[model samples]
Target: MMNIKNYKEVSSLWIEYKSGLKYYILKKIKNEDLADELSHEVLMKIYKSCCSGNEIKNIRSWMYQIAHNTVIDHLKKENKFADEVTEILGVDKNNTYEDVEEFVEPLIKLLPEKYSAPLILSDIKGINQIEVSKKMNLSLTATKSRIQRARKLLKEKIIECSNLEINAKGNPISIEIKADCEPLQKNSRKNN
Candidate 1:
């Protein structure tokens, strides 16, 4: 167990994991400013828990779990649940998709703008499809079509770039990125 009673220890922990925690939150929310704020909130939660004498068996995992839960709560508040993506990918909601969620934003970024814009506006931004259509100055049908095409393209890209392990119910249990996956590599580089 780690002792976090000392302020220096907690500060060191935050300094070490701050960037990684913000990146993790950014991947889920696709917003840099919000990710930073949420990461700070996560740090406070961790400090409070540790100060309360909680025994954290694995500090890294425990910190990330708090970060993940914080991101989920933020998404819930923004009405941006991953339900649409889960439905598009045929993944069961009951099975946690935390393993796969990190790849989603990168995959979406790999799509062509014609296909990706509608998806970003509607899905990631949590705007209604009708509002997205108007914002993009496209007919509702056209916006919907683009979003659907984007989903199909994203699914195909995921399959081409990774080896997915699916459960008996056809939900992706895990994903292993292929060694030569250039799109994901480029996306990661762009972010850095």
Candidate 2:
């Protein structure tokens, strides 16, 4: 439980950081009302986490990390919610890309850090190869090779998990993660 001083500190931090955090969220989400809502959600999440009695060293880093994940989750939910609405209204019939992404993200974690980090930075996070190389402290060529190897490994895992044969166009006939796959066991974090 937070003592009076700690509670005041948390409140002061929120007051100091709320506007900048809201602006960051607004820049990504591009909706004023939604950004405001998410900003409040961020503070609420931080408050809950703080009250839970976890020892937080470096509160700024902890808050920003939560902010980052919160934004990703909000964007994902926004997209998914839109898809759901469209599906219900019969506005779209194709779900192939979404389905593959749903499986691929989880599968990406099963890979070794060398393979996974590059792939995630370049492919998933949309960071450029050069930037990823710099970030990973690797030569550009090595980063490129790791990304390629990671994709190959991911493809093999996808095949083994989904039990599907790909067609000539390099598309899976069906993308489904098998329940008993190694990635599923390795990634124990339940999907929200």
Candidate 3:
């Protein structure tokens, strides 16, 4: 059982995990403002539960379970419950790589805008480099360079955040986030 007694420790955990939590919320709700609001609520709920002398066995899973329930409640309130259920049922569970991509997209959102913007436009959105260059108002060469740099930086961040082992080709061999590893920090990625 893990007990966090110090307020500072709690705040530090919040700082560390805020982005991942918000991303999880955003995945469920698909609304930025609502995700932010629900994330704050999740944080407050966790803090209160911890402070109330409850013994949390696995904090990360517990927090996510809470987040999941919160989303279900939100969906019910919005009367979108059936839609979400149908969507989930329609999804193919065998596409594990797609599952990882779903988790990874939110982590990518944590990267600094310069790196993230080009990466998102090029990789996630499937936009051509030339188009991304124009949208970013950078020369084609500079945009391509930034996109490459962003991929490198993003790969490093994913490895660091998840404590995953990478192959010679820089592909992750392990996708699980280590319990000891800190949850991903929010958009505080340094300027590169």
TM-score of each: 0.48, 0.45, 0.43
Which 10-residue window in model 2 sums to the lowest lDDT? Answer: 86-95
Give lDDT tens digits, candidate 2, residues 1-192.
123245567799898878877776676666899889888889888777655655443454455555655776776776757565334323111223444566677888878988999999999999999999999999999999999999999988777776443335553333435567866545433553
lDDT of 1 by residue, 1-192 (tens): 556787778899999988888877776667788888999999888777666765554566557767766776776786764884333224222223654676788888888999988998888889999999999999999999999999999999888887666545564544566779987767546655
How does model 2 score by TM-score? Answer: 0.45
The CA-based lDDT of model 2 is what?
0.68
Candidate 2 lDDT for residue 165: 30
Clash tally, candidates in order: 0, 0, 0
What TM-score does candidate 3 get on C-alpha atoms? 0.43
**Rank by lDDT (best first):** 1, 2, 3
- Candidate 1 local lDDT, residue 103: 73
Task: Give the TM-score ranking, best first.
Answer: 1, 2, 3
List lDDT for all candidates, in order. 0.74, 0.68, 0.68
**Clash pairs, model 3 backbone:** none
Better of 2 and 3 by TM-score: 2
